[model samples]
Target chain A: MNRRDLALGKLRGLGNSIIDDVENNMVPSIKVPSRGTSNIVYDEAKRYYVLGDRYGKRSLGNVKQIKKVAQMVSMGNFCKGLVNTEKTATIREMYYVSEGWDVDFSNQDESNLIVEDLEVTMGISREDLGLMPEEDGASVYGDLTLKDDDVEINAIKSGKSGYSISPTIDEIEFLDHGVERVIAVETMGMFHRMVQEKAYKKFNCLIVGLKGQAARATRRFIKRTHDELGLPVYICNDGDPWGFHIAMVIMSGSAKLAHVNHELATPDAKFLGVTASDIINYDLPTDNLKDIDVLRLKELSKDPRYRDEFWQNEIKKMLKIGKKAEQQSFSKYGLEYVVEKYLPEKLDAM
Target chain B: MNRRDLALGKLRGLGNSIIDDVENNMVPSIKVPSRGTSNIVYDEAKRYYVLGDRYGKRSLGNVKQIKKVAQMVSMGNFCKGLVNTEKTATIREMYYVSEGWDVDFSNQDESNLIVEDLEVTMGISREDLGLMPEEDGASVYGDLTLKDDDVEINAIKSGKSGYSISPTIDEIEFLDHGVERVIAVETMGMFHRMVQEKAYKKFNCLIVGLKGQAARATRRFIKRTHDELGLPVYICNDGDPWGFHIAMVIMSGSAKLAHVNHELATPDAKFLGVTASDIINYDLPTDNLKDIDVLRLKELSKDPRYRDEFWQNEIKKMLKIGKKAEQQSFSKYGLEYVVEKYLPEKLDAM
Candidate 1:
């Protein structure tokens, strides 16, 4: 059977079991592996979190559990309906559906938590259930063709207005591309400048805008291009703790999204950045490092994901300098410096 | 000429003045009132801050001022282009345009600040410049036809999915409807339940979901509906500090958006709420009052906007009781009770 059929069959079995439990006067329950640091093991080699044997169950006995089960059933039915109708919805749209289901979700975070719970319980990805989050934080310009469902388009030749990478990366199939490598930028402003300058054409590379932290789709797309086409991926971001974390997320994947990290991370990607050293080397304009920035840098120094010798030294340098430089600070040199000089030098070194 | 034409004309005049300065080798400068507590006076009568006579200038001499002027010019040009093309963009989109203009806005807040600066400088509203933020928070189910731009929508008759209030409130012209009043709810779940029960029809009133903290557009819409339609507006929220502030925002408007407060605030709107007294009087299920909630309540007790004797007493009682109740707690009585009983009783007293 296809993935959709398998997912639908599992859901049907769950529904039947619940019905049987009700008929037999027994409490209907679902057990899934618990999610947390204690129940999750960090695989050093794979650079991702894997679930442990510890399990948690939701049943109709306790008041809170009853509410949770109701939400699960509501979400399950919602997913089943989506599958039957061949429709897709964002997480925000699903949260709105809570209004009709009498489910009280105080915030988007609560709705997201329930979605994760449902995903764990059903042993299915949210993508398979046809639920996507709002597409954001990723833009691309390249000599590439992408087939999203039935529609196919040449992304690079699509003029100055580049393609916005959709959140549903799994549904998209890369057709053909002649790009040698991908240069992913953390800031949208820098990405736009590069695109406007036609830097992608100059370098024969794909330019991906991360916006801030790279979205799952952007990371997944980078991973796919790198793995399938043997394209070297490079990241460029601000010389700050937040920017460092963004690169880490792109390279090793984030712990917060550990469940689907394997499909979303590009471990082979290298940082071609506005690094801590770049602040002095390029003599870029710097802003005073806030207390929070310092704290974050210190925190990253201790993080396993950021334990690389090069990264550790970079954090130490930033802490000592007490200043951070934005990618936009390259504008202080000249408009063309970023696209013409800085990018070329970085890429040549890579 | 229409508002848009007038705005474009003013923008053109400003652009010509800058050109005149540059042509004559004169240092171009634009002066506007400074924004701060020093330049902002709290008008107790209006319950909002009014701009004072303190002025600041963006001139070509100072490097920082030069940068500011460059950003202003970039934004002005972007706005002029949007007007020329008859296109609307969110503040986020405006920030993306920064790259092409060689202007740096590191974050959305910075972009928003620049937008505010442009508004104060040009004496033109952002809406008039064809800019809009993302529409959110408010949902409406009523016997009302709303004319948004070119489209006319009958809100109540638009099936089960009610109309989400558009962010561009100024453009929305409400058509004739027989609804007597508007009941603005803080929670979507409650709003949905009320709509499902057709409680608005029973009471001959409109129901609007604030969806936690009401969006600026929602507030403006409520104010417009109250003033133009001669509808008595009532607010229902949780017996918590956040909920109380939501009512205050609707009534007096928020300090952050003080410049547009007059157009947004509905001072006559009454709080028909899940007040502290309701927990005891209605015997509603209460949660333990959080420390942050208590702190906020204490802070609001001292604020001029929340100086009503009834409101002060309510805050005092909440602190004394050490309990907070969500509007959703009304569900304990039964799904239909909130619609059939609580609302009717509240409206009758009002």
Candidate 2:
């Protein structure tokens, strides 16, 4: 069955169970995997966060749980209607859609939590349930042809700006490509420069500009591209703690989104510079590390994600140097310095 | 000559005057149009802000002005290099690009001001000088086909997410389209629904999602499309004051960007919906007007941009009702209610 059909079947089963309980004169309850930090475990073998065996039961027998159960039921019904009609709604729209139901949400955050609850209960993604995010995804450029909802687009030839990774990237199929690796850059300035210089052509790689910490769809797109195409994923971000965190989230999994790490994280992905060594070795323009940056570095150094000798040493060196540099700092040499020199040198070493 | 040639000419003229002054032992001075509020005047005929004939002279002879003049010269040389090399730099990159130069900016803001000063002095845009913003522009979808750097993309057929209005939209050519009007929606949620339902096909219009306040490229793209294609531009936003301000900025130009309003503003564009009348007439789910919202409404009512009877009436009605609604609030009726009922009624009235 298609993802939507599977999600529909799960939704029907959930509804039938509750109805069966009511018919048998028993209290209706739903068991959800607890999503607390304590329940989130770092899986060493798989190299991403996975849920531990912890369950949170919500029953209609309790007065306080009645409203939440009602809200979940309303949301489930809304999702069913969306899947049945072959339409989709954003999280914001879902919140607004609840206004018409008997049990409405007080605010968007409350509604968002219930959606997460529903996801954990059904073991399905919100995308399969016909829900989507409001923001657009990454800016992808290269020789890859992406097929979205049956529409084929040549990423590089499409436009000067390249292809925008769609929010509904679950349906996007990587039809064909002529690339060796996928280099995901964090900043837009660096990404645009790479596109202008056609850096991907020289390296035989696809350039994915994350814009910042990537959106869910962007992470998923990168993960899918890596798994399906067998291309190595390299993350290029600023030489700082925050940048390291963003890279780690993509490589491993973030605590907040641990549930879906299997679908999002690219454990095999490599972190490319701006490393502390590169900062010192290249004599690039630098900024003084803030207190928060130092604190984050100390924290990351201890985290299991950065347990590797390279990451550990880099974190320690950064802390010792007390400096950080951005990807755009290479513009000091010239606009094409990063793509022509830094990237070529880094890639050759890799 | 093309824009790049024109910009180069202006840059050379500025350089020549300085060299000529030094040769003749005269004080090198650059005359810049004062961009203060006092010099920014609303053009009634043009329906946008225009710079008045107030000049600010900076001479190298003054001790305080030496650094400023040096910075301006450095910026001019940089722009010339960009134009001659046919390379573009983001304002952020421009800041870093100055590190090797004699006069480097302390921060991005100082560099941005110099670029603006260069624009006002040269009477040419940064785009003409091969400079771009760091952020990407709007998301557009519909029947329109855009030709960028000699590459054509059919917006609807391109991808599921549509065409991302390129950051360097100055180079994009709107070749041809079969659409009647362009509907610019302020929110992404509404725009996504419109795209999902093929609402543009039924209305014979192009849908441009602004994401919030539009970037300069988005406004330029819309203005160019309106001027070149003879398509009426309609703005659809929320029922609150902030939404009205966003629409007004697109239609009449904003104060901060008065210098480039001639190229950005779409004066003839109509505000289509989420007005006070829309909130009451359609009975949309709304939130109580915050203090800030009320204050903005009062300010807008006094502003000359909303002097029209329709806008003035809506402002007063919104204050009286003390309510505000988002475009997504229409989802309370059903997912299709907007494309089916509300939009058609609003379009008929227009």
Candidate 3:
């Protein structure tokens, strides 16, 4: 049988075309594990198969077309054989997986491939990679002693070049001076706004969300900052619930990730700037007050784990005022207000 | 032993709260198949007993969170006294498969949980009464749909209703009316904007895409739309390839649902409007075009499946223009201009 028929018609029809790819030499841009079978030959024990055969007996469709599987693992490997044989290694900056077969209102059930994680694997070492690090992903930092001695640090250390991710491990290095801190902003849109106002060079900021989910990834990075570099971390989020939840997830740890990796929050770092205080502190707009945010705050406070000191106190402040504050509320403070109110004031302490 | 320590902790730390929830309630929010003993039970197969009665006398997390060997069946008819009370009834949705150790990612991975289709019931049936659809934890369209069609649908659809879901099945009927055309916009924010412009109310536009990521569920609704209402559908999407592909999925069908149900989109339906043509026709901004999106369009033009007539002509147009068009590009034309440009000027042909 031809490879296409063997891979599709005979092999239970994954309809994968990587079989022709393996034969023709289609190299993937990302890295695939040097070991393990391609999606071809299923493994009952591991519950998935190496998509293609390492022996060249089987074929894989082009790795790019295969969405559901961890194609990057196969792509970067086979791509070396296809496009470049001189270098066998390729680094992975992101990994996407599906929640699977997204069903819609129109009877269109396409595969729902969500970007699972966008980790900085280029600089991660196997030694640095823990089997299940107290966290799922690992973060690295340069240990440094900065100029500021009196200001207390409350976040993961900052001060790394984020011109873009360095492609190789060897290219990854420590910053020459420690005057600035590298605060990974999850979204580039937010970063651009911050930079337009000169928010980060003043404190050493690293723009993160340019490629990944940006928000959750930054939290993990900051936690890594805490562990690897011992930088104090603080979260400046919108006073609204979604923003609050994102910040809280960093603080409380995701239940899903709790099973997978570590949480990144200071035992003491707290949500700053976007507070009910911002509503009164800056006389912000109340049209933005959402009923759900109020409801969510009440729900969060009632949770047994958060009923204690920090959350309850913050929640009670809003309950007393019956107001909601959002990170956007600080925008009225203008770029200068954000820096002075939260960032610079905090940096001055640093 | 604490419930968690039992069964050698095989299903350890996996949604443990779900088990404690079962301990207190008989018909828990999630109804799991009984991990009963193997006595050649439900299907009258080779009746065997467990190594011990450990499988039969199981609880999600009671005296001990033990799942008996009996609980590991591909089919559930063998067990007696399942809480949902199915004697000959097939397993429709598995609540907490004692064996669901990993993430449920694909149709095939999920198929493994079922011994056979005969062992499980399929589709919504009159028999599945008294049970809330959401209780099954299966995908459900559960929210309100504002009747205004001009509103940028995606924006309101983007609103968080403390849920990942939007618009229940009952809600769709309210909007269907005598409308002759159904346009399922995958992005709702754009739909809401159109509503503000009085596009739907003015021109009888039936815009979908109030829910993101529920593409599969949305597809089911489309099947209902076509089968129940003979509306000629037209998919309006971003000019990029994924948008093009999503339109293809709605019309041509996807492999994942090929076996389960067929015929959501009609063969005669049109794939119209908001494609790469907008980049040149309207001069839309490229500032926010994701790099990956540009690459995907390039790849789409090259793929053999898409190289044929309609796709080829459209893709070539984009390449010639060298620009990507987002749905928002239509904003320049205003709702009136879009209807003037894309919609059939005469609907009497219908």
Candidate 4:
């Protein structure tokens, strides 16, 4: 069966199971895998976070659980309808859609949780259930060709701005490309610089602009490019703890959404910096580390995802230097400096 | 001469005039049109804000003005190099690039002011000077065809996600499309819904997602679509002062960016909204107006942009209702209800 059909079956099965419980005069209950940090396990083998054996149950019998149970059932019905109709709604739309339900969500956050609950219980990604994110993924450029349905989009030929990654990335197939590696830059300015200078052609790679902490679709796209297309991924970001965390989120899965890490996390991705060391070596224009930066650096230093000697040393070095720099700081050399000198040097070392 | 040549000539001319002054042992100076609110005027003919007759001067002789004069000259030289090399830099990149110069910018805001200074003095858009904003423009999905250099992109055919507006919008030419009108949406959720439902095909119109306050390129794209392609423009946003203000920014122009309003504003664009009447007539799910929302409504009521009877009534009604609703609030009917019902009603009324 297709992914959509599989998702439909699971949603329907959940609804049927609840109906069966009602017919049998037993309390209908939904078992959701606990997504709390305590139940979140760092899977060393897969190099991503996963839910542990712990599970939570919401039942119709208890007043405390009744509302949640109704919400779960309503969401299941909604997902089934979406898959059946071949229509999709963003998580926000789903919240608004719930207003018509007898058991409606109090807010978007409550509805968002139910969607997560459905995902965990059904063992299906939200995309398969015909739900998408509101924000777009990322901007991509270079020689890569992506096929979505019958339409084929050659990123380089699309336009000077290239292609915006679809929110529902699962539907897109990496058709063909001459690129050997993927270099994801954090800032749009640096990304545009690379595109303008045709850094992809010079380095034989595709450039993905992460546009800040990447949306789930952006991470999925990067993961797919690395695994399905066999392109080694390298991330270039500002020399700061926040940048490191963003890179870490893509490398491992984000702790907040660890349930979908298998599809989103790219463990093999390498970090190409604006590293703390690079800030010192290149003599880039620097900003004094703010209090928040220091706090975040301390926090990441303890994070399991950034526990490696290299990351540990870098974090320490950054704390010692008491400064941070953006990727565009290389523009001090010239506009072409990042693509021509800094990038080539980093990639050569890799 | 072309725009690039025209811009280069202006920059060089300014430089030469300064050189001539210096050769004659006179202090070098540059006159910049004041961009403060007091120096801002509403042009009734153009229906957008324009700079007034007030001017500010920075000369090399005064110790207080030396830093700014040196910075302005350095920026002119930098812009000349960019034009000569056929390169582009973001306002942020220009600040970082300043690090290599004898007269470096202390902060990004200060550098941004210098770019504006050059723009005001030379009467040239920053795009002509090869300076671009870092933010990507809004996403567009429709039958519209855009020609960016040799690449021709049919928005509808691009992918389900559609096309991202290029930051440098001047280079893109609106080719052709089978669309009668353009609808710019404030939220991505509603935008995605319209795209998913093939609302463009159904209504015979193009849909542009503002993704919040419309970016300069997005506004420019909408303006081009309406003026060049003869498509009427309509804006759909939440029933709030902020949303109304965003619509105003697209239609009449933003006061903060008054200098570029000629290129960015669409005076003929109509507001098709989740207005106060719609909130009551449709009985949409709503949130009580926050203190800031009320304050904004009161402030907008006093502004000349919202001086029309329609806007005044809407603003007064919104304050009276003491509540606001999002575009997604229409999803209370169903997922497809927005594209199938609300939009058709609004478009018909227009």
- Order of all candidates by lDDT, from best down to worst? 2, 4, 1, 3
Stretches of candidate 3 exceeding 4 Å from the true structure: A1-350, B1-176, B210-214, B261-266, B287-291, B298-308, B333-350
Candidate 2 retains true contacts at a fraction of: 0.70
Which pairs clash in model 1?
A: none
Report backbone clashes per prediction.
0, 0, 92, 0
The TM-score of the first chain in every model comes to 0.90, 0.97, 0.48, 0.97
TM-score of 3: 0.34
CA-RMSD of model 1: 9.5
Model 2: CAPRI class: medium
lDDT of 1 at B158: 34
What is the DockQ for all candidates, taken in turn? 0.04, 0.75, 0.01, 0.80
Q: Where is model 1 chain A poorest over a 10-residue stretch in terms of lDDT?
A: A153-162
Candidate 1 lDDT score at position B76: 86
**Model 3 chain A: ten consecutive residues of lowest lDDT:** A90-99
Per-residue alpha-carbon lDDT of candidate 1 for residues B84-118, written as tens digits (9 for 90 to 100):
86655556556654645566878668888888888
Q: In model 4, which residue pairs have backbone atoms overlapping below 3 Å?
A: none
True contacts kept of 4: 0.81
**Per-residue error (Å), model 1, residue A316:** 25
**Per-residue CA lDDT of candidate 2, range A231-323, in tens?**
999989998898888889999988777778888999999988899999998899999999999988999988888898999999999999999
Measured on C-alpha atoms, candidate 4 has an lDDT of: 0.88
Predictions in order: lDDT: 0.76, 0.89, 0.38, 0.88
